[model samples]
Target chain A: MIQIENLQKEFTIHHLNKTLHAVRDISFTVEKGSFLGIVGKSGSGKSTILKSIYGTYIPKSGAIYYDSETLGKINLVTASPREILHLRKYEIGYVSQFLSVMPRTTALELVEQALLETGVSYEKAHEEAIDTLKHFDLDESLWNNYPNYFSGGEKLRLNIARAVVKKPRLLLLDEPTASLDNASKLKVRESIEKLKHQGTTLIGIFHDLEFMDGLCDEVFTMRKAVVNAYEA
Target chain B: MHVEQPILQIKNLSKQYGAGCSNCLQPNARLEKNFCPVCKTVFACKDVSIDLYRGEILGIVGESGSGKSTLMKSLYFDEEVTSGEGYLEDFHNGSLNIFTQSGQQKRYIRNALLGMVYQNPMLGLKMSFSSISNIAEKQIAAGSRHVGNMVNRSNELLNQVNIPLKRSKEPPKNFSGGMQQRVQIAKALSSNPPILLLDEVTTGLDLSVQASVLDLIKTIQRELQISMIVVSHDLAVIRMLADRTIVMLNGQIIEQGLTDQILEDPQHAYTQQLVYSLL
Candidate 1:
């Protein structure tokens, strides 16, 4: 569970001395296991909000509270870098819009590394990675291929599989299906649906309203630095 | 006087994306698959047909993406319908399909015939507009040009919803969540539309606040006799307000009946979980 209160985030262009307000006093709560979708047009700060939740972009004001089962409630905004790192490694997972290309690493190794870092055995990690790639409908031939060699959609699905390999408690996605075609999108939706049914809390920014409508339990719309939310 | 016909009639409505090909060309064949095997089309809504009588509350209960909101948005002209017909008794002689109407005609129908209360008050209320002016905007949209009449009607509606006259001049940004919702309700009722569509109106509110808003809604429904379609995931909200209920799962209505009968004897597995969870 997470509670974001009066969250404000801004980016400063030092050269121009101009401050870009990204999130302005937005407050909302995401219940555990529920999917919260953030929808907005381009430049509406939807991704900024996701980044803030992911703890990569600290808010200029207000607090983000995470109700962890083991650690109790912690303020993410004020959380130490180590604490944030630990949360990311164990509790929170993020899938960015672009895949961070690992030139020499295969897709299987990339996903297996996520599990290995979480203390899973190397053999177990490999097996799980295979299953995850299959769930994403990634072809068997693509598992040993480098992300750079994969198509845009293949890379995105690999990114998703890697992020969700550990089955983190909360998963943050920025345009999860942005690069996929209709069939691939459908495949990814099935994977997301399976994850949801398994009780993984999801927060994503989807410009595709119809996709978001079908996937999200609640949706927040960002406009002019303010946010308004509604049930899906 | 004779009983009036239903204000809204939806017939075999289906909203799907992509054109089906050979393998999935049969009607509703796409719905059985995760995605259409032929075209990869997703079914956002499927053959949803329902009617809203003149003065009755029709509740649509479902999990997210069950097509409940899509169904409402289609009626409000917010989402375009892919197929099937809908007719509003008071618009275009009751024979013209509301879904097929031109954008201008749809806008006219939305302004004069329908009122919507969103789950979040911020979506419905202009936070910077004075509470009175928020109500006035709807009246003005319905072609009320006289400021005096608009203000009078705004005040009357606000009073009916129990929003104080003193706060009517102030913007809604400073109001509490419940007050903001009440203001949204007042604004929605400003034009005295024949039909009101509510999407999870009490969700995310504190229990006491939810009760008060529900009470206000009940009073308004009884006093104004406006036809309604209320969509919610919460069964209790539906039980408290709706006369009839439709249970939806994955873009299809799994069950429909009187609220009491459906709750008492839920036949569908999903409806059973929903009803039992409420208890």
Candidate 2:
């Protein structure tokens, strides 16, 4: 299970002369295998919650628990350089909304890099990457081509393949289906469900209401940077 | 609703080149319907002709590479249309053939009359400026600024979207994705242009934000009485707001009808997949 308690994030804007509370005392949880949807208007601090959980954003006050493993201790918060590498190398996979693939990189090479970072064997990484590519149903012939030539949907799926190939236990997808067509989105949704069945926990910031209502096992609604309520 | 008086009109709309096209399984050009030697294949949006009515929200729904963006670009693009004519009926009422427009005409259309909103708010806004300044710049550029009007309007827009007014003076870069979007809208409305072209306006928002933004757009359209043409891959947003829908695949409008008919009982195979894939 995943649990968060009383998280707060404040940004001091010098030019604006104000302390903006991006997130305030927000908390929510996802039971194992539960697909959780976090939904809110822009600036709702939904992204802050994800960042805090992933250790990207340090909250002023809070506790995060991943199945009784205390995730909020100062030691855990101030992870060593090696430990930071380990955090990214294991446990979690992230796919962001903006297409952030490296410039001039081939789709294959992108996934390959993710594998390399995780310390997987080179030949084994190639095999695993191929399997993940086929799993997402991306065109096999285009694997060798630069992502510069890809469609929006194709690029996003490629990013997903890269993230999921390592098979991280927890996956965080921000705006996963934003520009996807209905057909492509349906396929991606299927892959996400398959991940849950494989014991992957998911936390996504989504805007597609029907997808959230149908795909999510539960939903959390946020207002003023906090999860106001949880619905099943 | 007489079809004679168009709020916005697209005549022989086409955007072509040595092909600055983005690669996809589909194409993104609006050509003269199905006649292209390139790709040894079809043009993206072939000679598309459509009329948007005042106070009506028309949606352009297409898969990636279907030339929806290209079509949109041809309309409100900073660049004038390569070939074709678009007549605006309400504000800046001009018979712009686009093909034969002077540099002044192109600049005029880019600055005024045509208000364009993109998917990424941060990418759209000027990061150096406060939200208030962003709107003010748009007003000054469009030559339509009100003294203290921007501050009042910016705060109102922030409140409308449920953001605190205290954040109104902050650089939009500091706002959340949703708040930045509101800033974009505030800027879009700064000049009070009668026609708004939204290209995936809610693209990066979370689900609740999506619903709220879609609703916000719907509400804005009604309150402002501005004609809107929204292009999106999300059929739900189109269904919720658009009076009319056009379903495009491979630069072709396979189906066009009332939003309810298209959503509930679509005619095209592609349209069926679009609606069914919603779940």
Standalone chain B TM-score for every prediction: 0.93, 0.85
Q: Residue B170's C-alpha lDDT in candidate 1?
A: 95
The TM-score of predicted model 2 comes to 0.50
Scanning candidate 2 chain B in windows of ten residues, the lowest lDDT window is B17-26
Per-residue lDDT of B83-157 in model 2, one digit per residue for the tens? 667777753564556546676776666567777888877656997688878877777777655768666766676
Tens-digit lDDT track of model 1 for B51-123: 7787778899999878888888888887888898998889865889988878888888888899988887877
Q: What TM-score would every model get versus the actual structure?
A: 0.53, 0.50
State interface RMSD in Å for all models: 29.9, 26.6
For each model in turn, which proportion of the native inter-chain contacts is also found? Answer: 0.00, 0.00
Candidate DockQ values, in order, are: 0.01, 0.01
Fnat for model 2 comes to: 0.00
lDDT of 1 by residue, A41-93 (tens): 78888887777776666578898999875567989888744456567768888
lDDT of each: 0.82, 0.72
